[model samples]
Structure formats: C-alpha cells, structure tokens
Target chain A: MALTDFSAEEQIAAVVAGETSSVELVAAHLARVEHDEWNSFLAVDRERALARAKEIDGLATRPPLAGVPIAIKDALSTRDLVTTAGSKMLEGFRPIYTATCVARLEAAGAVIIGKTNMDEFAMGSSTENSAYGPTLNPWDLTRVPGGSSGGSASSVAARQVPWSLGSDTGGSIRQPAALCGIVGMKPTYGAISRYGLIAFASSLDQVGPFARTVRDAALLLSHMVGRDPMDATSLEWTEPIRVPSATRLDGVRVGVIEELMSDGIEPGVRAACQSTIDMVEALGGTVVPIALPHAGYGLATYYLIAPAEASANLARFDGIRYGHRTADADVLLEHYERTRAEGFGPEVKRRIMLGTFALSSGYYDAYYGQAQRVRTLIMRDFAEAFAQVDVVASPTSPSTAFRLGERTADPLSMYLSDICTIPISLAGLPSLSIPCGLSEGLPVGLQLAGPAFSENRLLEVAHALELAIGFDDAPQGVGV
Target chain B: MIDDAITRHVARLARLGLTEDEVVRMQHELSAILEYVDQVQGLELADIVPTTHAIPLSNVLREDVPTPSVSAELALREGPNVTADGFTVPRMG
Candidate 1:
C-alpha cells in the first residue's frame, strides 16, 4: 500500500504494531517528496531527519504520534533546518532554538520531514510571492495551491505527508486547505504558542494544522495547544477536550453567515455549501441564515489592523540584527537601503509601506483607530450570531484555486480572495476547512466555524459531514 | 486625508527612499484604499472598547534566567565585516 494512502492515525498504528520503524517511515516520506513534483518543500534535511528517526525508533515507550512524518511551515524556526520564511532576507539564518510548536511535535515522536514553501513573509494568498517559486496545487499542477501555507496544505492534499503545520495570519491555513482539498484548522488565536513563528502580524498570527481528516487534525492540535513562556500572548485553557465520536452532531445549531454567501460566491461553490447545509439538516442539526452587519467591512478592517501590527513587528529586521545584510555600504543609510532592497519581496515591501502609512502621525486616528473600532463591531456581530447558533457554515473561499499568476498582477484582487474566511479569523474563532465537493475538477472546502476554544466541537461536525459527503482519493493525474 | 506629503513622511519613517514617481504612485493608491476605509468612521463607537487581539491573552513569562549563547566569534561569522570582539559595520554618524 502507498504510505500516503494511510491516515495519520493508521501510520501511528503501523509504528505501534511493530510493522515498521520510524526511520523507515521517514525514509519513505522523504523519497515520496523527492519524486513528487508539487514543489511543496523549500528545504528537505534528509540526513538530519533520518538521524532523528533512528533516535525515535530506539524509544521503548511510543508516544501517541511515534514515527509519523509531518511538514513544518517555513515561517517557524527549526534548528536542524534553515528558517527562511520564504524570503531572501533570512536565506542562511539558522535559529539557535526550535519553535515551541516544533519542539512539542518533536517530543510527541513525530518526524520533521522538511520545511515547506510560503509567500514571502506570509504576505500573499497564493504562493506566487515566494522568492523561490510558487507551490502548485497537487490536484491541478497548472493551478496554485492556496497560500501562504500553500506548501503545507498541498503536501498533505497530494498525500505527501500525513499531516503538517501551517500558520494563519488571515486565513493562511484554512484558505489553502480549501484550495488544496484537505482538512485544515486554525485554532483560537492564543490556543497555540507563536514563539518561533517569524511575526507577520503578531496580533493575528496563529499556528494551525493541515491534515487528511478531522480526527487527525484534532490529534495534532491537542499535542500543540498550550501556553508557552516564550510567547506572552499565549492562553491557558485548562479544560482538556475529548474528541467527539461519530454521533456528536445531534441537536447542533449551525448558522450560515448571510453576507458571505451573497457577496462573490461562484455557482458551483454555492451548490457545495448548500449540499453541506442539507447534510447538516438531514442529520437532525438545525441550519439558519444569520446576518453579520460588520462582516461587510471585514477585509477593510483586516488590512488596517494586520498591517499596523506588521509595521511594528517587522521593524526588528532592519539589518542591525542577524538577518540578510548588504555589501559595499560605507554609511548607515546606505546599508539600510541595500539590505532591505535586496531582502524583501514586492508584496512584503508594499505591506510595510501601507502599514507605515496607516500608522503615521496624522493618519493614525482615521485609519488605525477607526479600524479597531470596526473590529469591535465585527466581534460583536460574531457574539450575536453565536448566541443563535452553535457554529457558522460557508465556503472557505468564494471560488476554487486559480491558476498561477492569474491574480498576481492585481494585489487587491488576490487579497479579496480571503474575504469569506478573514472575518472568523479576525474574531479569533476556531474554524475548519474540509473537502466538501469539486468544482470544475478543483476541490472546494466547507468552512465550519465555532465559538472560541470549540475546536473539538468543530471537528465533530466536520467528522459527521465527512461521513455524509465522501471525498475522492483519486490523484488528479490518474483519472485525467 | 493622505497626499504626497504624508506619503513622503511615512516613507521616511519606514526608512524607504522613494523617488518622486514612486511617491506619486503610492499616494494615489493609498488614498484610494484609505477612502474606502473611511467608511468605518460612520459607526459611533463611544461605548465600545477597542480590541487589539482576538482572544483575551495573558503574558507567559519565564523567570529571568541567564542562558548561554554562541560565542561572539561564531555569532559574527556570518557578518560581512567582523571586529576583534564583535561584528564591525558602517559608522552610525
């Protein structure tokens, strides 16, 4: 059987049953990643990975995820691998320590197969902004995998890894998962530690998982969720969530956000959402249409708040520290110019400029402060909607994955692709994207969002829907 | 509310040296986006508290423990220019 054919749980079972060793599993995955042409990885540290696998294989006591292979998003720091953040700025910069999330995964006995590609500094929705190259959707090589977590999402969707980690600033995890046709979850903002994640917009940045199934996503999430001393903003939720069994969706009330559906949804995308809604209702769950008044301006609020925070968080990369430095500079001003000019990509530079402009002295009140007030309104809207329903359902993106360079020329159009998923992210709620159906042979996702810290509940609903609407396991090339 | 003057000032704060043409381009683009965002001012939010983060967060801090780092020699290895004890660079003034 193909290694990717097994779910994350089954892989662990294989390790536990003495059918294989951790090194063998790691070797198999590395081989698959090499032969696979998705360009999902930026750096694959085979020697270090095989060495770690041998060490884990010697363990007498197996952890829950022993020997399972997973990919790390390039944005996080890993001592064994170069933490590039998909930009030339940190090209050779090796972090002294591992990210808390990566450390936690390592402790749980999972193997770090490689570092995946992303938009430079996690700035774009598609991976086209990577200084290296774009990550193509495994389903359709001509098309983009959803991004800046595109590499992580596409790897799992292509059956290259059982599960992988991705960071979400504004729908980075869920958006790509939808585009790649896999299960992805962005936990409540502070639920996972952000210690080693290179800050894009610190306030909104979060680490999440992309998996082949809801249960697998939850299993990885449970391992990664906890407060860490390194990240001051991390939260401590004392209650341990039990993974819901197959029958947990009874009497659940799911609210469909009215504004998201009417805005820019394509015809096939709408049908898939309605099909999921019908499945929810058939299973004795109630589905209702609800209005989020502030959601109409969600994109606007995100641009302001995220960039303002980014402008502050990114100031530390000004060449005085340990990142890319320029040559032939006799003076400080010349050094700053050469370093940044060579380091950052067009998208990152654009955002830094826009954020700097927004937070400048005279414009601060009108742009940044006004954006915050509107954020309050958006949060209130979610609060009111949750009062009437247990979860909200929608298409993860307005349309399926587009071709590479399709929207690269227009940055605004690319940013608008995140419209539907950005609101839930802004509210710091838990959301999951599961493969619902196909549109024009490309995969679309059904986005299920629940109240804060309700990851288990959200996964339970996704599990129920997965059973209702089965997904095709056929690789795109085989049938085509 | 934003114009070429504001763009120049913001660029300076960002430490970006933009030419006159780049300044004009950014001014028009930022102006268009800011005008769209101005719609947020329509809401009266006197009663609401502004939120900086989505979740209520508590700072997780470790005890101030001294940790060992790489020796200065190794730290400055990647530096283009190195001093006897540290990294050397262009003069600040």
Candidate 2:
C-alpha cells in the first residue's frame, strides 16, 4: 500500500491489531520520507526514530495513540533530533529536553517520524523563507504548498503521515492547509502547550494539527493538548470529547464575514466559497453576513505585535545560548554582530528590526501600543458577531497557490495573502480549515471559526462539512 | 512615506547595518507597506477590543520540575566552537 494512503487512526489500529509493529510503521514512514526527500523534512533522525519505535513495540498495552507515526514541525524542540526552526541560526542545535507537546505525543505512543521544513522562524507566508530549501507542494511540486506549516500540511496531505503538528501565527497553519487541501486546526490560544515550540511571535503563535481528515486532526490534538506548567498559556484539561461524525449543521448559525469577500478574491475561489455556504444552508445552517469592523486592522495589528514579540523572543539567540555561535569575533559587539549576521536570514532580521523599532521607547505608543488597542477592537468585533452565530465562515485564502517566487519580491502582497485567516487568529478563536472543493484545479479551503474553547464544535462542524462534500484526499494528478 | 530616516532607525534598533543602497530599497518597500496598513486606519473602530491571539487561557502552565538536560557536548554540537563547558564566541566588548 502507498505510504500516503494510511490514516493516523488506521496506522494505530494496525499496530494494535499486530498487523504491523511500531518499528515496521516507523521504518515505513522513514523510508517514505527518504523517497520523497524533496517535498518534506528539513532533517531525518532515522536512528533516533527507529530506536523509539522499537521501544514502543516492546510495550504490552499501547496508549490511545500508540505506535501512530507522526511528524513534528521544525519549530518544535526534540531532545533526540535537531530543532532548527528551518533557520541556519540553529542549524545543529539540539534541545536538552523534548517540548511538552512532543513529550505528550510520545507518551501516547506516537512515533516521531522526522521534523518537517518551514518558513524560517515561522515568519513567511511561503516555505521559501526557509534557510533550508523550500518544501514543494506534494500535489504539484511546482507551486507552493502554502506556508510556515506548508511542509507539515503537504506531508500529511500526501499521506506521508496520518497527521502532522504545525504552528499557526497569522495563517501559517490554516493557509497552508487550505492551499494543500487538508484539514488544519488552530485551536484556541493555549489549547496546547507551547513549552517546547520555539517562540516566534509569542503572543500570536499557537501549535495546531494538520490531517487528512477532521477527526484525525481532532484525535492528534486531543493527545497533545492540556495545560502544561511550562506553558502558562496552554488549555486546562477537560474530558476528551469525541466529535461524532453524525454532526449536522442544522440550526447552527454561521456568520459569513462581509469583509472577507471583496473584488480581489479570485473567481474560482469565490465560487468554491459560495458552494460551501450553499452546502451549509442546504444542511439547515443559517448564513448571515456579519461585519467584523475591526478585521480590517488585523493585518496591521499582527505586523506590529508579532514583530515586537519576535524581537524579544529572538534576542536569546546571541551565539552564547542554545543555538549557533561564531568564533571569529574579536570583541563582544563583534561576536554578537557576526553571529546574528551569519546566523539569521534576511526575513528574520527584517522582522526583528521592525519589531525593535515598534517597541522602542519613543515609538512604542505609536506602534505596539496602538496595535494592541486595535487588537482589542478586533477581538470585540468577534465577540459581538458570535453573539448572533455559533461560528463564522470564510475562504481560507483569497486565491489558489501561486507559482514559486511569484510574490517574493513584494512583501506586502505576501502579507495580504493571509488576510481572511488572520482575523480569526487575532481574536484567539478556535478555527478549522478543511478542503471545501477545488478551484481551477487547485484546492481551496473553507474556514469554520468558533469562539474560544469551541474546538469540539469546530471539529463537529468540520466533520459535518466533510460528510456533506464527502471530500477525500486527492493529491495525485493535481497541477500547479 | 517611509524614507531613509525610518530605515536607518529601524536598522539600528534591529542591529543590522544595511548599506545605503539597501536602505533606499527598503524605504520604498516599507512605504508601500505602511500605505497598505493605512487602509485599517479608515475603519471607525471606536469600541472594539484589539484581538491578540486566537486562543484564550488563564493559566496553562507546567509543573516546576527541573529535569536533567542533555550533555553540554550535545547541546553545543551545532555551535561553531565550544570550550570550558561553554560555547566560545567572539569577545562582546
């Protein structure tokens, strides 16, 4: 059977039923990673992964997710593997301990296949920003897979794993998932522990899951979630809720944001979104046009606040702690300068400087403070709209995947690509992106967004949508 | 509009010493970006609460457990140099 043909649940069932040992599953996945070397991982820790899988096979009773093969985003720390954040700055840096999420997944018997590539420091809209080579869209190989979490999304979409974890700040996870034609969830901020995930924009970053199916995404999330002492922002424990596949959209009020739809949206993408809404309506869900008056400011607020936080979080990579160091500097200033100059890529430095400027004492009020106030308004807009609806719906992106390097010359254009998805992240709401339908031979995503702690509801609705469309994984034979 | 002054200031704060040519290019690019952000300024958002993140949590924390870390050799493997149980680097002063 094709490696991309198995689901995470199926893999687990196979392991449990003794049809395949944990070591076998790990070896299969590792071989697949090796075979598709160009599209996914930044690094493959075959020895470490195989060793762990062998250990798991020896266990008597496996956990709920025992022996399931999984991939971690390069952004997350792993004791046995190098956590490079897809940046040269930490090219060979190994963490002392596993990140909380990775540890939890391991405890559940999930095998860590390898770390996938991403935008450097999770900073770009496309994986092209990676210090390592950009991850190709498994579906096309010529077009982008969507970004930051692009590799994770593509890996799962191509069935390299049943599911992979990704980090969403702005639309990192959702946009890539949308573009790659998979299910990606950015649960309520702090829904999962961020203890081991390298900090990008501390305030905005949330670790999420990418899967071939909505339930699979939910299952992966369940194993990795719950509060962690290391991450003050992780969600508190709650009884695991299995999102029934029978969920119907009937009587669920969904608000379709008017601001998300404008002339700029491609014709095919807009049509797909309309079809999704029609599907929702056919299922008895009410679609209302809601105004997110503050959503217009989401990109602006994110640019300011994310950078400010990034400036601070990235300050720790001073060549003396945890990451790459330079030995050629003759003085302290030279040491710091040379290390950073040689370590960080252009985009990372660009953001750090922008953030430093925004937070500088003289400009703080005009930049970061104003952005924070704007964030307040954006959150309030969601609060008001949710009073009238259980969820909000929108296209995950305005257009389908563009050719590689298409927007590299224009940063603002790249930033605008995330417009529809950023507002949900800014408000700290739980949102899901599922493959709604294809547009112009490329997949377009339908976003289902709900209020805080509404992950179960989001998943249920996503599962319902999945049933309505009967969407299946179809990465083969797609063009850029 | 963004100009050389803004680029210089931002670069200084970011600790990047960009050349004049790069500064000129960045100034033009940032000016375009600021113009895009200007669109948000037109919205009448007097009472809305600014949104920061998508998830909300009061205290998702970890236990105060200090675990043993990997050996220093492993931690510093990626570094360019290491000595005396520490990563060696150019002098800060």
Candidate 3:
C-alpha cells in the first residue's frame, strides 16, 4: 500500500503492527514537503523530523499517534524550530519551549513535519496579509486558500500531510478548511490550551485540527484537549468524552439558523446547505428553524473586541524585547515607533489603529464598551437557540473560495467572508466545518455548532453527515 | 469619517508611526470600519451587561511554588540585541 493511502489512525496502526516503519512514512511526507507545489510550508524540519521518526521506529510499544506526520501552524511555538507567525517581525525567531498541544502531539510520537504559513500575526481573513506570499488553493491554483490558517488547510487538501494544526480566532480554521475541502473544528473556547500559541485575540483564539476526515480531526483533538497549568483559562476534562458509535441520527435535532441562510449567501451555497438539511431529515433527524437575532452584529462587534484585545496583547513586540528592531533610532520612543512601523503589515497596523482609537479615553464607552455589551446579546442568542436544538447548522462561508486577488482590495468585503463563522467564535461554542457537497464544482462546507464543551456530540453529528455525504473528493493530481 | 489628525494621533498611541500616505489611507479605512461597526450603537443596552469572557472565571490562582523556568540565555536568544545577561535597547531621551 502507498504511504499516502493510510489515514492518520491507520498509519499509527500500521507502525504498531510492524507493517510500515515510521521512517518510511516520515520520508514520504518529507519528500512531498520538499517538492511542495502549493507553497504550504514556510520552513521544513527534515533532519529533526526524520530523527524523531527513527526514534519512534525503534520503540516496542507505539503511542496513539506514533509515526504519523503532522504539520503545524507557525503560530504555535515549536522548541528549536523556526516560528515566524508569517510576519517578518519574528522571521527567524525560535522559541525555547514547544506549545502544550505540540508537546503532547510530539509525546504521542507524531513527527512534526514543518511549520505552515499564516496571515501576519493572524490578523486577516485571507492569507494575502502574510509577509510571506499567500498560499494558493490546491483545488484551483488561481483561487485563494482561506486564512489565516490557509497553509494548514492547503497542505491537508494537497495531501502533503494527513492532518495539520491550525489556530482559529475568528473562523481562521473553519473558513480555510471550507475553502480547501477538508474537516476543521474549532472546539469550545478553552477546550484546548493556549500556552505556546502566539496571542491573536486571546479570548477567541483556539488551536484546532484540519484533516480529510472528521475522525482524524477527532483523534487530533483527543490529544490536544486537557487542562494545562501554563494556561490559566484551560479547562480540565472531568471524564473522557465518549465518542458516539451510532451511525444513524435518530432523535437528533438540527437547528438551521434562519438569518444565515438569507441575503449575502450564494445560491449554490444555500442550495447545498439546504440539501444537507434535507439529508438530515431523511436520516431520521428533525430540522427546526432557529433564530440568532443578534448574529448580524457579530462581525462588527468582533472587529472591535478582537482588535481591542489584540492591541494590548501585541504591545509586547516593541524593540526592547524579542522580534525585529530598528537600528536607525537613537531615542527609545523613536526605536519603538520605527520598529513597529517597519515591522507590521498594513492590516496589522489598521487593526492596531482601530483598536487604539476604540480604547482611547473619549471613545472607550462608545466603541469598545458597546461592542462588549453586544457580545453579551450575541452569546445569549446562542444560549437560547441551543435550548431548542442539539446542534446549529449554517454554511461555513457565504460563498466558496474566491479568486486569489478577489477580496484583497477591500477589507470590509474580506471580513464579510467570515460572516457565518464569526458568530460561533463570539459565543465560544464548538463548531466544525465538513464538506457537504459541490457547489459550482467547488466544495461547500456545512458548519455544525453546539453549546460549550459539546465537541463529542458535535463530532458525532458531523461524522454521521459526513458518512451520508460521502465526500471523498480529493484535489486533482493529489494523493493519487 | 475620522480626520487625518485623529488617525495620526491613534497611530502614535499605538506606537506605530504612519507615513503621510498611510495616515490618509487609515483615515478613510478606519472611518469606513467605524461606520460599519456603528450598527451596535442602535441597540438598547440599558440593562445589558458587557461580556469580557464567555466562560465565567475569576482570579485563577495557582499554588505559591517556584518551578523551573526558561533560562535567561534561552529567553534572550531571540532578542535583536543581547547584553551580558539582558536585552539591549535604545537609550531613553
């Protein structure tokens, strides 16, 4: 059997059964990374990856993820590995400690293949904001792989690696996974620890997994979730989540958000989502119309809250500490000013300015304060909706992936691309994006969301739908 | 729309120096974004409280025990300029 044919779980099983060696599996993926046609990885750690794989091959009892090759988003710090976060500010900076999630994955014998690219400081919707170039979509090279986890999604779509880790603050993981035709899950906030992740809207940011199948994502999440002493907000799992084994969706209540299906959504995307709802109903499930009245304000509110927190969180990048510094300045103030101006991209600067203005003395009550109040209303809407249904469904994006330069010209239009996913982030709910069907020859993502800490149930529902859809379509010329 | 003066002022507050062109562009863009987000101003928030976090937690304290931490050398490894035991920076005015 070919190396690329096995799922992540199967790869682990093969190594345990002595059918394949970890070295061979790692080498096959490393070769793909070296010849990466999609520009997915920013830095390849071939030597270290092979060394780890060799070590795993020598072991008698294999771990859960032994010998599986996984890609990581550069936002997560990998000890002794270059983590650029797709910005020139920290272009060659290497962290001394690996992130908790990464450390756990490594402990499980998953070989870290390389670091993937992302939007500069995870600030933009499209990967075009990266200091490095944007990642091209594997489906259509002329189109964009969504961001800020574009590289992670594209790599998985191209089958460079079975799965990759991506961070989602506001739809970064889901939108890109939707565009790339893969599975992406943003677990309930604090479900995964954020110890080694470079901050990007800390309250909303959560590391997630991207894979070709929902089961693969679930396996990754099983290792990623757990309490961490390093991250104060991390939640401890009281008991192991029981993965539902039932194949049918009998007695399952799926809530279709009435507001999300209306205006701004493409006809094809709308039709595809409706068909998924029909599929659910036909599979012994009930579909009900749910209301999220305050969801319309989610994008606007997120722009304020995320950037406001980001403005404070990102203040540490001044020239005094780590990251890029300006040499032409003699005074401390000039050093800071020039360093930040020279380091950050346009989108980052825009957010900093917007956030600073919103939090300023005179405007705090109007912008940041009001955005917080609206955030409450948005969460309450979700709480009320969850009371009526077990899971909420919507299109992961309003439309399929657009051309590479399609939304780059206008930031507002780019922000609108995340309209469907942003509301879930604001409410800190668990949401997964799965390929429903083809729309205009491109894949459409059906988003399944549930109340906080409902990851197991959410995944179960998604897995059932995934089996029904049978979306095993891979990008052309990939994994053949 | 916010004026260029406010945009420049905000940039200064953010410790980012914007060029003339960037300031002008920021003025236009920030105005557009603010106008869009102004939709929140229409809500009736008389009794609604602000939500800073979805999960309610307060003062997450840990045991008062010292643990091994990243060495100063490793921490300063990524600094642009390093001194004998610390990071070097521009002199204050």
DockQ of each: 0.55, 0.50, 0.85
CAPRI verdict on model 2?
A: medium
Which segments of candidate 3 are over 4 A away from where they belong? A242-244
What does each candidate score in C-alpha RMSD? 2.0, 2.7, 1.1
Which predicted model would earn the best TM-score?
3
User: Per-residue lDDT tens digits of candidate 3, residues A259-278?
Assistant: 99998899999998898889
What DockQ does model 2 achieve?
0.50
Candidate 2 C-alpha lDDT tens digits along A305-331: 888999989888887766766656688
What lDDT score is found at residue B21 in candidate 3? 94
Error of 1 at B72 (Å): 4.1
lDDT of 2 at A161: 75
The chain A TM-scores for the candidates, taken one by one, are 0.98, 0.97, 0.98
Point out where model 2 deviates above 4 Å: A1-3, A477-480, B40-79, B87-89
Ranked by lDDT, top first: 3, 1, 2
Error of 1 at A276 (Å): 0.7
Compare the candidates by lDDT and give the number of the best one: 3
- Give the Å error, residue A190, model 1: 0.6
* Clash list (residue pairs), candidate 1: none
